[model samples]
Target: MAGDAYEVLLTSTARKDLDKRLRKSPAKKDKVAKAVKRMREFGPTYPSFNTHQEKRTSRADDPTYISYVEHNTHGAWRMYWKYAQDKIVVLYIGPHP
Candidate 1:
């Protein structure tokens, strides 16, 4: 893995969200882990089925520019994030919003 490809950071809420999801379906850990790996290696252009940036109006009041990666093949699992320089901070990980 290229440590410098993208520095992956996870927010506390995102970590909790992933934990909750993992608790519900432990079998998905591999998929989630692979998704994170691909995301880090390829960033927002990870070739997922649907990847997009959230519009300001949809973000409520949060000022950080965020994007989403549709990681699930047949479900709504998504990875919400933002990129600046080489940082890729994950803001959320759960159902599509």
Candidate 2:
């Protein structure tokens, strides 16, 4: 994993969404935790996407173009990351809902 650059950055909105979901349902919270653990172990390799939405306006001006993969857990969570020179940079994690 040398030369690999990975980071997880969660937007405020996404954080709030996850918090809301976790507060609303205990089952969902467990599922979310499990999914995140899996992601940490395996990286963002699930819920592959052929196409992804353009970066949000808040992040549009950023030079890096972040790609996302959607994971279906209790509701749905998104992993925003980028790959460069065999390195995967995980930029965000949060609930899409």
What TM-score would every model get versus the actual structure?
A: 0.72, 0.44
Span of 10 residues, lowest total lDDT, candidate 2: 61-70
Q: What tens-digit string does per-residue lDDT give for candidate 2 at 1-97?
A: 2332343445576567667756766556665565555545555544543225445543544323333333454536555554445544444545553
Give the per-residue lDDT of model 1 (tens digit) for 1-97: 5574677888899899899988997877776787788777766666562566577554554434444334435665677776655687888776665
Candidate 2 matches the true fold with a TM-score of 0.44
Residue 47, model 2: Cα distance from true site in angstroms: 7.7
Clashes of 2: 2
Output the number of the TM-score-best candidate.
1
